[model samples]
Target: MVTVKMLKPYYIKTDNEHVRIVLAYQYFSIIIQEKVYQFIPIEANEIRINRRTQKVENIDAKFAFQHGKDVVYLTMAKLITLPDFLQQLHSIAGTYYIQDENELNGNSSIQHAVLIDELERMNILRLIDKALDERDEKSFYELVKLL
Candidate 1:
């Protein structure tokens, strides 16, 4: 189930060549980006966090092609509206050839998982309370602007 802090005004961006997923993690939010049909494993080090003040140091991210098959993109900056973004993603998916039509049609779902306890500036914030947090200031500044 979507949690209290995450059930607020937040944004996402996905595109033909990229996909951006942002969720609140404890005192900070984690933004994950993956290129279409890529295998970019999420590295623990890649997640940016602030330790002293315990805040997210960076939010702006670039999704590079992790794998060599399909393409995905960031959801918020490109789509502008969530509904519109989803619609576009659907249309784009329809354009691809289905190797296993049934498999492609398999049911899936999306849920926002909270990594932190509360929301900051309407977005999930306050990660300092959690264990082993990292902060990247430049990234946080970028995320603040996007959120």
Candidate 2:
């Protein structure tokens, strides 16, 4: 039976589509048969997650483990067998996922505010143009002040 001793990403990188969990030496460890094995990044150094679905996209990434002189390279497919390990990984990554969501929401709100401001400005410009067309000096002055 395999058991996870420790699992932590060195850092998380986020883009528009994906979140990457970068791993470093000694950052992840597991135990099998009472012997602790530290994970070493080999073919795979990072796990990619889909930002929208929050699901791991790279399960085939490889990692090496060492216990004394014996080293075994395994994939996420193997590590994911341990329910505890999977749960912990999700818990850690979920924090970053939530942060990404908050950031996107904040950005959307800012964009919405900008859009609203632009729309209001356009309306004012339209009113100013109407005032000029009608030769309404008082309305034109008031609209210009708004600008």
Candidate 3:
């Protein structure tokens, strides 16, 4: 999954009222909105923003933020190179806070995480089945909308 705030390094992503991020892989992501729209390959980047147009380009900061609690990785923007990602983790491992303890599922954020994980997985399956079966994106999207 992906977060909109995390969208800045790529194209201009609005819809700020709600956002979510998940480490679908070590980097790449799928972003869904209001349980309806979905976008993929949200990468991390070092960027220069065009204030007037609200566009972003020049990705350079892609890396993983890791802790015992969770790990955060970026993909779509391609901000940081793989080497940079590893170096950052090495440097931050000592000074940065890494939550290496058990995950707590008490907070609403955690609950949302759980919900997204389950729903995204189901949605992915649906997307694959539809694509293979020649189902329409509209129907698949609507199914996810309800989900």
Candidate 4:
């Protein structure tokens, strides 16, 4: 499992008691257990939210990967996009690899997990909101440019 701290934030907002941040492409990696795995993130085509729980539904991304002695046919389920938090979890559903004569056939599976804090996400949004609310064009545009 890859912890959230393993990700470097592109932007961070902090108060005396709170922290929020945004993460971007530069924050992702496909390596697992010291071995490099190849992965490509296609796109996030859908975004959903649950109003009652204030929880955002999973964002779908097309991903593909090939690893030594194993190959994983990637799908949206294997990629997790956290839109609100500006984060993404690659191989969240786990990946499988099987070694066969064809090299593409395998029965082995791999799992990579990403974690993010809801409060930290909210803090990041609020920081943006504050910049807009104050009509701080400089700060607002700076933040927007990161997106």
| Clashing residue pairs for model 4 | 95-110, 96-109, 97-108, 98-106, 98-107
The predicted structure with the larger lDDT, 2 or 4, is 2
Give per-residue CA lDDT, model 3, range 1-105, as digits (tens): 333322222322223221122233233222333222222324532333332233333344454543344455654254333444334323322232222345433
Per-residue alpha-carbon lDDT of candidate 1 for residues 105-146, written as tens digits (9 for 90 to 100): 453211122323224534523433121155666656665565
Predicted structure with the largest TM-score when compared to the true one: 2
Q: How does candidate 2 fare on TM-score?
A: 0.62
Candidate scoring better on lDDT of 1 and 4: 4
Whole-model lDDT values for every prediction: 0.32, 0.84, 0.41, 0.42
TM-score of each: 0.20, 0.62, 0.21, 0.25
Off by over 4 Å in 3: 4-47, 76-147
> What would the per-residue lDDT of candidate 2 be over residues 1-147, giving only the tens digit for each residue?
788888888998988778898988889888878999987766788888876677778888888888988887877788777799779878877765645568889999999999999999999999999999999999999999999
How close to the true structure is residue 113 of candidate 4, measured as C-alpha lDDT? Answer: 17
lDDT of 3: 0.41
lDDT of 4 at 123: 67
